[model samples]
Every structure is written in C-alpha cells, then in structure tokens.
Target: MTRSQALTLKSLAIEAYQPGQFEKDLTRAEAARRIQMLRDEIALADSF
Candidate 1:
C-alpha cells in the first residue's frame, strides 16, 4: 500500500490498541499488517 494508506491503517491500529480497541471493523491481523507496513517505511527511510 502507499504511505498514505499505510498511515491511515497505522492510526487505526493505534486506536485499536487502546482500551476500547481502535477499529471496530478491523481484525488483529490487519492491525499487525499496518504496523508492519509502517515499520517497512521506517526501515526504508533509515537506509536512505
């Protein structure tokens, strides 16, 4: 996914991790995927 999409997902993931959970529609696996995507982006930026 593009960075924007990943960012949106990451936000949702963060919210989901909260006491009430982030996205009511998103599964744990999906949250993990978003986290991974963000991590990948960070790693790419770090390498630059």
Candidate 2:
C-alpha cells in the first residue's frame, strides 16, 4: 500500500481507539481538518 494510504488508515485508527468517544467532543473545524487530511492522503494514494 502507498504511504499516504497507510498514514490515512493510521490516523483513522488512532481516532477510533474508543468508538463513539471522540465523536462527541471534537469541534467542526478539528473534525474537518482531520477528515480533509484523510481525503488528501487517499488522493495521494490513488496516484500511486
């Protein structure tokens, strides 16, 4: 797998350490930033 994809998965994995936990308190901007980063990583991976 590409580095970008791997990193994306890693970030998600970290965020999901305890399901439905962080989801409750994360602000809109923070969540958007994290998800946007994941999407960018996916796009980078797709190029590989």
Candidate 1 structure quality by residue, lDDT tens digits, 1-48: 445554566575455443333344555576667567665665666798
Off by over 4 Å in 2: 1-23
Report how far off residue 47 is in candidate 2 (Å): 0.6
Q: Write the per-residue lDDT of candidate 2 for residues 1-48, one digit (tens) a residue.
A: 344544544566465452332343455566666666656656676798
Tell me how far the alpha carbon of residue 21 in candidate 2 is from the true structure, in angstroms, after superposition.
12
Q: How high is the lDDT of residue 40 in model 1?
A: 68
At residue 24, candidate 2 shows an lDDT of: 38
TM-score of each: 0.47, 0.49
Clashing pairs in 1: 15-22, 16-21, 16-22
